[model samples]
Target: MTASWPPAPLSVDEPVGAPTLLPARAYVRAEVLAWERRHLFAGTWSCVGRVDELPAQHGVTVGDVPVLLTRDGDRTAAFANTCRHRGHELLPDGGSADGRVVVCPYHAWVYTLDGALRAAPRFRDVPGFSAADHGLVPLPVEVWHGWVFVNATGDAAPFTVHLGELAGLVAPYAPEKLKLAARHDYRVRANWKVIVENYQECYHCPRIHPELCAVSPPNSGHNYDLPGAWVGGAMDLREGAETMSLDGRSRGAFLPGVDRRRVLYLALFPDLLLSLHPDYVMTHRLRPLAPDTTRVECSWYVAEGVLDASYAERFWDRTNRQDWAACESVQRGLASPHFRPGPFAPNEDAVQRWVTLIRRAYLGTPPWEGQ
Candidate 1:
């Protein structure tokens, strides 16, 4: 079925001169990265991975803080990966527990799948040591549309609350029923915010993404300043183009209930990037590793039972590499002493909004106010 060119109203108001990009220090300063680790990443709801990844128990690192994820009965739990006894890590990165209890490799301290302290080798002999008080420190964990999310500080708004209207905007895709098709990981030599800002705007599409611009013109869409953590909108595909594949063809049926001629892309602040197409969904989970380095994990999801995902995967794999290369170059440029903030194009309203959000989160003010 044919759809309108701009699927939704533009959230940004009348045209204004491009605002300046974030200062170079925001990308290269060690203190800036540390501030983000505490204020932005620690206090936000970050998409960790698919709930299926941790069938029993698994360990991961979020913004350098080791975390343990476990599936307990029908509920999922997240906790500090360190053992309370001696601060030793309980499980190795991505390591899984065989049964219900996760045992620390260092001292054999054991904890149940639900994060409750079950046993400590010799702690019972202590006069005042209490297993009840020494259970794994729990962090907030929630599952949305099959993806697991955790808040390191356990003080952010609920997952649904932070998502706001994004849940309804993507409801047509039925992401809840989609199954993981493939995954790829990349080590990008760029700041996490640089990567995020790049994804927030497509003004560079004509210069950097020839194949993408061929299927979806760089100037053919508008951005939405949606409420909550997400900022995105739909972009129309070229006439007769069925999907955003290398051949501009459809590899499978449209997602169960979504029949549209436009693709939706949303950057859920701090970590998750969601791209919704008629036939499949692509997500990028960003992990900030250092001031000038980031780890990106990308995954493709399609309706259950669809075997062939080569077209979409290859297309995006190429597109993602191009984006990462550009981001790394920008990171290098920002380090130059002569590099100064540049103006944002009218089409880059989303990037401006993203910068504003980051400033608000980290400095408690807008970027222009010297934050």
Candidate 2:
């Protein structure tokens, strides 16, 4: 099994070069909020909700925004789930139906599945109103396999195109076959950038995630890149660790179109991550709770019908708890008067790479376009 399931080579290893080191102060600055509004919340591809979570009448609340993601044949669509009139939320928190029309609770402003305004109450009397002009606003949504992503501002580059160099990084472990398993949410008394940087590298994993080190190789000990920008790098499973496929099949068993061979950890820009291992997959979304606080929600995934429940949850939950404790501690330390910026290890280049990219993008100087 080990011989057949060969691991692929890592991505390019050239240093990101000088004048590109990640700035430590960007994640929590009030000034950075404008950038997020311009680049991330409005520009980059962002996850909306899981595919499995979109069966019937389900919805996920992002800030004051309520988004409805639903399936139509093999495709999915997202709509701003708000009534065109009184601003009432359209669907109940979690419910589903096999129909195409959405009726608002307050005034029955019905909309087509494609988000066009279908009918409204008292239309004839509303002199200046036109249903065609008042349809539900559509968010820029793209579905890769079963994961759903949205670009809120309706102006981001095409989703796949924006993923750029990351496309091949996660090619080994198929993202489509993964399913949600377990979830844990954390409200941290820290800024959003701190959580992202903390997750960018495993340099502190040996000191922080001792148990996770037993399963996934620790990056600091190995020669893995720590991409400083919003980049995700993979770490191979320990040489002979116990492994299972998402379908409950042991390593090497194929699940139709999936490889099911190894593990992958995916970090999407701004605030989402997907950690795929041989045994299970984990998903995380970071919501800014405040200028000084952020909420981290995590969900684990397995193949469609497999149920290890407590066992799977325990393993990933332990890793998450460890991460939370470490990140919180780091947040507290950042308040200290003497902390300073530093250099990166030659081998631990992944986190540094991500930092550099993010800093450049936020400053409106993307990597591709020269300053």
The models' CA-based lDDT, in order, is: 0.80, 0.61
Query: Over the full model, what C-alpha lDDT does candidate 1 score relative to the true structure?
Result: 0.80
Error of 2 at 227 (Å): 12
Winning candidate number (lDDT): 1
Give the TM-scores of the predictions, in the order they appear. Answer: 0.90, 0.76
Error of 1 at 127 (Å): 3.7
Taking the tens digit of each residue's C-alpha lDDT, what string does model 1 give over 1-371? 11111211112122356567777788888877776675466666778888866668888876657888888777899999999889998877778775778888889998888788899987779899888998999998888888888887766767766787778878888787988888999999999989889987888999989989888878777777555776777788999899999879978768866756888889886799999998999999998888899999999998877888988999999999999999999999999999978877888888877876665554353121222
Which stretches of model 2 miss by more than 4 angstroms? 1-25, 34-38, 55-75, 81-100, 104-107, 125-130, 219-230, 244-262, 309-311, 366-371
Error of 2 at 234 (Å): 2.6
lDDT of 2 by residue, 211-276 (tens): 667766665233234332246555655655544222222332223443343455556776777665
